[model samples]
Target: MTKALTPGSIAPPFARYSHAVEIPAGHRLVVCSGQLGIDSQGDVPPDVEGQTRLCFANIAAILAEAGMDLSDIVRINAFVTGREHLPGYMKTRDEFTGSPPPASTLMIVSGFARPEFVVEIEVIASAP
Candidate 1:
């Protein structure tokens, strides 16, 4: 079983994640492919908020396929078109990762292949 990060004002709700993950030996890790904001219909959602939400949903589905959840995530990476919607991005992230939240890296890029597309996400999870 995996343990949530210990709580504290200064601590990241959990003790370890990504570069911060501190698991012992004898455990398995599951790394997920980068998830996009596209729907199962293969349609990329418009708007950063919508795309970000869809990306997390896609990530969740992948985690379930591997018998894991967002809490088991050690590291997360998010790429966006620009910084205009960053605060909103954080809000979208808060919905999936609450309390201490996860170790995340957010980047702003010039654009994506699909012009309508606004975001892409990736995650790494491990267990004992």
Candidate 2:
């Protein structure tokens, strides 16, 4: 299980995530690379919501490749090109990973890996 970090007399973390994540002491960590919305055919969808969905799908696929599932994800770092599109991305994300959502970091970068990709999602999985 993962718990969201909260400062207790310490300085806050620089990153805008919910804070840090408290991973179990004995869990092995899995750091997944940033996942872009582009498909294997070398294409990125124009729609921000669609791209966000695909990006997460790619991340989940990577987890499966490592013999894990969304439940194993302790943290996530996502980058969206346009801050205005956050709601749409969040909606799609909820559809993909319902209930006890993993701890996450959402960033609004100037842009993404490709111009057409409006959103990119990355994940960190831990196994106890």
Which candidate tops lDDT? 2
Supply the TM-score for candidate 2: 0.79
lDDT of 1 by residue, 1-128 (tens): 43444435564432223224455578677888777788989887567788889988888888888888777777788888888868777778878874345567888988777788777788877766
lDDT by residue (1-128, candidate 2, tens digit) is 67767667787654334456677789888899888887888877888787877787788888888788777777777888776878887778767663345667778999854577778788888877
TM-score of every model versus the real structure: 0.79, 0.79
Query: Which lDDT values do the candidates have, in the order given?
Result: 0.72, 0.75
lDDT of 2: 0.75
Candidate 1 stretches with Cα past 4 Å from truth are 1-19
RMSD of each: 4.0, 3.7
Q: What is the lDDT of residue 128 in candidate 1?
A: 62
Residue 127, candidate 2: Cα error in Å is 1.6
What residue pairs clash in candidate 1, if any at all? Answer: 5-13, 5-14, 5-15, 17-20, 17-21, 18-74
